[model samples]
Structure formats: structure tokens, C-alpha cells
Target: MAAIATDTHPYGRVSRLFHWGMAALFAWQFVTVGARVLLPDGALDDFLWPTHKPLGALLMLLVVLRLVWALVDRTRRPPSLNLAAHLGHLALYALMVAVPLVALMRQYGSGRAFSPFGIPLMSGFEGEIEWMTAIGGIFHGLLGWVLLALVVGHVGMAILHRRLSDENVLARMAPHAGQSR
Candidate 1:
């Protein structure tokens, strides 16, 4: 049981859970965004569009939890491959927190109620706050795209580490079936 939970050059179970779970959710986010950009008011976009805000809220919650878990388990986690990896991850975390926060600000500023997953987060206001909405409108989509690019770079670097440096970085987060440590 200790072995199952402890990191031995590989990520622990909880860390891997957060990593992979967030990866899937992020993938869905990208798909939804892609539909919005490429398909617009088409059927696919229409179907996926409604999920965008709610899922963003969920991702924000997960990211906050993941951040806290990472801090608590810092001593038990695998080390960054290098300075670049460390900075890249830091940027990813920053954007993960920033993107949804800006959106929430915009939602609130727009004088609209927001109830993601049916939990009332922001109540409707009588009038809009221009500055908050403007800031959110300007940065939210831009930062989201930047984060996606960084994620692509992150995955590429992991594969490059395996092929070029013989470092099985992905294995730390995604070990094979029946494999431990």
C-alpha cells in the first residue's frame, strides 16, 4: 500500500490521477473551443457550445485542488526534468488558474447569473461593469489559446525526452498497466 501511494522516480497514484484526469478534461475543452472557432453556429458547435462555460468552471475547481495537492505532496513528487520544464509547468499552472477566473469575472461583469453544474456561483446584477468584462473579453480567449500551445509544447518535450535524451518522463505520470513505481 505504501508502494502504491509513494513515488519512486514515478508519480504517485494521486498525482497521476490529477495529471491524466486534467489531460482528458483539457482535451475536451480544446475540442469544444475548436468547434466554436471552426464550426461557429454549425451543428457541432451548437451542441458543444453550451458545455464550454460549465466545463470551464469544473476545470477551474480541479486545477485549484490539483495545485493544493501538488503543494502538499511536493516532497513526494518527481523532480522537474530541468529548468525549462519547471518554468513550462509553472506557466501552465498560471494559465490554468487565470483563464477561468477571467471568464468568471466577465460573467459577473456582464450582469448575468452563472450557475455551473446548477450550483449558483454568481448572482445576476442590475448593471454591467465595463472594465471587468473588457479585461476578461480581451484576455480569456487569448490566454486559453496560449495555454493550448504550451500544452502542445509540453507533450512534445516529453516525447523528445524519451527519444533524444532517453528520459522516460511520460512514464513518471503515465506508467504501464500492472506496473508500480
Candidate 2:
């Protein structure tokens, strides 16, 4: 159907799929982090902590695919709500890529094998690399928190734009809904 592939109207099926699917995954990722933080060394932490890395790896892969899809669909997609929205999206993309990348670098530096979803990503080494681990240690949690804040802001702005300006910002991506463009 035409609606399945054109964001100039409503967002295309593929784009919506990527957006909402990633949103759910990101939500789960944050839940895992929250559990780890709030219930440290407890049963909840034990259960959620293990899912974090594997889910993060999965998210990394999906983000890459989504970015490529975005580029390919650039002309077909609706324009951003404003300059701030454009820049906010860019920041989201950057942090999405950077967070997992640094975590993987740290994994490599730890001289440990990483096999997310049972696929061998890295082979364990004999010794650790200090600088890589240091960078990961310093930035991973900090940037993750920052990313969370940005995500919250993003959601808030979407709602605010819709409520205060009657922009229908949220509807643009929803099924059979309004298009700002």
C-alpha cells in the first residue's frame, strides 16, 4: 500500500517499525539499568544486569540498521518540526552510536570474550588495555544517564509541541494520523 512507504503523509511502515521497535528496546534497556542501580546485589539486579549487555548489543545493531534506513528514506521522510528538533535527533543518533561503541571497546579492553546472543563478537586476549577500559568506565554510565535525560526531554517536547502549539508532532509518526508537512 502507498501508506506503507511514505512519510510525506504518515510515516512509512518501515520507519514506524524502526522507531517504535527501538523505543521498546530502549525502554527495556533503561529498565535493566534502573534495576541494577536501585536494587544492586539483590535478586532483581541479578536478573536484569545480565540482560543489559546482550540487549545493548542487539540495540547497537538495530540502531545501525535504522540509521541506514533513515539515510535511504531521507527524501521520503517528513521534515523535522524545527531546527531544535533536527539537532536533538542528531544528538540522539550520536549518543546511540557512541554509547554501545565505547562499551564494546571496554569489553575488548577487558581481555574478555563477548558473545551477545551466542555469536562470538570478540575473542579474549591475554591482558587488558588500560586506556580503553578507562574511557569506557568514565563515559559509559555518564553518557547513558545523559542519553536518558535527552530521551525524556525529547518525549516532553513532543507532547509540549502538540499541546501548546497544536503541532500534531506526535501524530506524524502514528498510524493513520496527522502529518506536519
Leading candidate by TM-score = 1
Error (Å) of candidate 2 at residue 74 is 0.6
The C-alpha stretches of model 1 lying farther than 4 A from their native spots are 1-8, 177-181
- 35-139 per-residue lDDT for model 1 (tens digits): 999999999999998999999999999999999999999998887868988999999999999999999999999999999999999999799999999999999
What value does the lDDT take at residue 161 in candidate 2? 65
Per-residue CA lDDT of model 2 for 116-162, tens digit only, reads 98999999989999999999999988889988999999999876665
Each prediction's Cα RMSD? 4.3, 4.3
Error of 2 at 46 (Å): 1.2
Best by lDDT: 1
Q: Clashes in model 1: which pairs? A: none
